[model samples]
Target: MLVSVKELHQQTNLGDVHKEKPKKFDHLILGPAAGEGLPDRLQCQGIKALNKIHFGMSRNNSRSIDPVAFVTVFTIYNSTVESRPVDLVTVGNISYNKVKRSLAILNVFINFIQVNMPQSKVIILTDPASELPLQKDMVTIKPIQGEYSRDKLMLQRIRSYIAFLETRLEKLSQKQEQFTHFIFTDSDIAVIDDLGQIFIDYPNFDLALTFRNNKEQPLNSGFIAVRGTAEGIQRGKAFLQEVLKVYSSKFMKASRMLGDQLALAWVVRSNPNFNVRRFSRREAFLDKIGGASVLFLPCSSYNWTPPEGAGQFHGMPLDVKVVHFKGSRKRLMLESWNFFSSSSDLSDTLCLILKSGRTKYDF
Candidate 1:
């Protein structure tokens, strides 16, 4: 039987259950709720109301988004306070297509958090007037100010926005007392299991960084965990900004394939506070390979690319930990989406994409 929200709370929380229903939230976002089901009628109404209020409160030049694109929700009850511990944050640009995929990704992430990390609070930071709302344990905070250019530059907008996240995060470092650790993950990525064990078990690691094959190159920038110390945060922010600038410039000038991964590596290499560590690449991929799940994801598997069997190592086991289905390559996604078993909801999500390629969001 599928678990209800209340059952989720009961199964996970290690604290007293009598705590008032979390009305006042720590953060919010325009994403899916923690469930296997889609949004209900009441949930849809809530989203519409939240959007109306968000837009109504906007300035004359504010941007608006479809209410269905971004669902507003509260805390995910799966993550246990004792198991997965840390402050959660997400960074991404708001686009019609991206918003839809992001909502789907958010659903998986929320459920992951609910089942694994209960104590952590998730906050989403995005462009100003981005139309996110405050939920139970989740809050939405717009950065102070930033510019998103629309020039005919490849990956420029994405890199610039990532740079924006870095700048904003640095400012947040000044107020370290407010949080213990800050995590920045891409909306395209989803958490397949509990992350607290990785953090709690390991020592002498300041930051948890994701990279491609340990070729001393950065290929994936989907997941990042930064220490809360002033210097640590500064280092993390600087790493992200510099890497984004360099990598973005490369992609813009050459129109080459080097994407978020190389840029992420640049950031880590440049940042003094970073202690980059590699994890299982297979574990990160969404497709089930061998029995073991993919965890330390490679860049090729995480980005938007056509489904060619070239990336998969046939000899390996079939356990996909996280999957990054970037919306850029619809055709490739369609081909690969069919490979997964019907058990993987991603196949259905992929079918949705294939049916409506390049037509903007529809999840």
Candidate 2:
């Protein structure tokens, strides 16, 4: 029952073919934030429309330096489910403390992009008017509004995941002209280093994503990058279509947790010619799975989590570029913001490791 790369991607040419010329985005870094901190479970209330507000960015507002075109996609879905905790908002109303802390964390990453990555323009994608105070300079807001069925998928907020997949990919396949590539990531993480170099170094890869669950059939859907070439966009669009086509089938339901993430994994792993890009360094291949052939970038560098304790990086195993902040919400939140907000960003982080003589810090 082994499936080779050929069989995996053999039928990629068998999907709906959209016109191959439309405006698409380049260097788009997007994510899902439909309902991150909202208290009420808005069950498909105001679906079918998106209320948008573009701040400081119009077609004619020219800036001295054109920044990197990075985007953050957020959603306030119509489902009554909260897949993750609300770290930035409180129950029933927005909390000032929560807002301050979360915005600080966001600023750390955004501030870094502005300072270190001067040319990389950052776009903030979120649900229409969540009232969260976001950084203004070198930032653009793209609000997504959509009505989705809540009863499907048990209570997971992955409807936005599927929606984003179909909407974005379809647009790209239509020759959506704008950006060159797209990176989909989670909101609760901070970037301490520049990841744009990865795409630049390996331009042939149609898709680049992180691995999880022991490199199984599904790549971590939250963190993915898609090249915007004709073939690249086509593969991406087809994969997304297949995901929606069989979303309610027996296989997805039986798994009990295969959202768009698993669907994407199936497509990429099945296709042999997708031209996936992995980390160039050897360290990334340390935990390769037999069948999941990807440029397995080292977790330590791409998505690093604490080994033990909450938010304490005393003994980090690798040179991390991003701290995913998966555990201990408050601690990670505070620490991540402080990490970049203060003068001690990446340089200081590395120096501490060298100074500690590779011994894990005891803080």
Candidate 3:
């Protein structure tokens, strides 16, 4: 059911993969129009195929998978080198790049999403001053109300995230039922595979966060998933409010540069109501944070980053789905993207990653 990278390229006829310049993305619309729902075949066959081949859900038990059930959100703001600190500007990274390169990488990221998961909705939260070339039908772009600043980068992100959750909560309260699950990811991430299987495999979770192997900073806030049920939305809001409270507190002033991540880690580890249990076999964990079920997935599979040096992708697992191009690694992500796009030997890693035997959902 899950198509391999090579097959995907063949199906899409993505020719001349060695183009030095990135492709133009203005006119690309991979899915149905704005109000138009998913294509008939996808609506009928998508989930059933997934269940039969990957999840093992029986026909009687499987839920009809709506393309609108999943929404992916991204936030981007304009920041100039003059406004940022001396350490921020670089050619590969987008945080402080000039407008041209920043938009280029953003285009590539969105292109990856469009190619891999065309049916899902995409929301882009950005400052009004920021320019995005995306078509409204292809993806929704909402401009946040506020002035952009270099010093408050993390704060800006937190505000955008809060706004996203609030909008979803309001829709749920009104019984609009636009979507049931939402994924909030940093703009630097490249989605290599379908993310719908996450909700199917871990249906009971309220919040899902990815964690790196580091003990000091075990959690990485780049990739976060939230269930849109009433209780899940309420708890998610409360948890984020708590993180904001900690982030603004006087005690966090010394390490404020780390911003929301520090606050999030503190709340998860130091809060009396939170209980973390690591999976004995895999690099996953289950955390109960103030009655909310928080699933901690390993970054190795979800938010994977390439190691230092050239040709390091050899060590990358075939099952990696979301690749994060943080800091200096942005260059590597671009190179790796070109490499993977051009390479014909790649197998359908999604099937390998989502097969029942590869991952257990006992928690």
Quote each prediction's TM-score. Answer: 0.45, 0.54, 0.66
Models, CA RMSD each: 19.9, 19.3, 13.0
Better of 2 and 3 by lDDT: 3
TM-score of 1: 0.45
Descending-lDDT candidate ranking: 3, 2, 1
Predicted candidate 2 versus true structure: per-residue lDDT over 16-98, tens digit per residue: 44764322211111112232223321111121112221112212332332223555554333233433443333311333243
lDDT by residue (tens digit), candidate 1, 101-174: 33434544454444334545565544453444334454344443333232322244344344544654666665
> Candidate 2, which segments miss by more than 4 Å at Cα?
1-68, 75-104, 129-132, 147-178, 212-218, 244-258, 268-296, 308-319, 350-363
Report every candidate's CA lDDT.
Answer: 0.37, 0.43, 0.56
lDDT for each residue of candidate 3 in 1-363, tens digit (9 for 90 to 100): 123334444644566666545332211112211111223211112112221112123222324543423233333444433443533433323333445445556666776776666666677787777766667446778787654465665666667777778887998889886656778887777787677667677777888888654545667777888877778777777777777788878334533256777777888887575544442123556668876788888776678654421112223344456767665444433433443455521232222222211111111
Error of 3 at 127 (Å): 1.6
Please give the lDDT score for candidate 3: 0.56
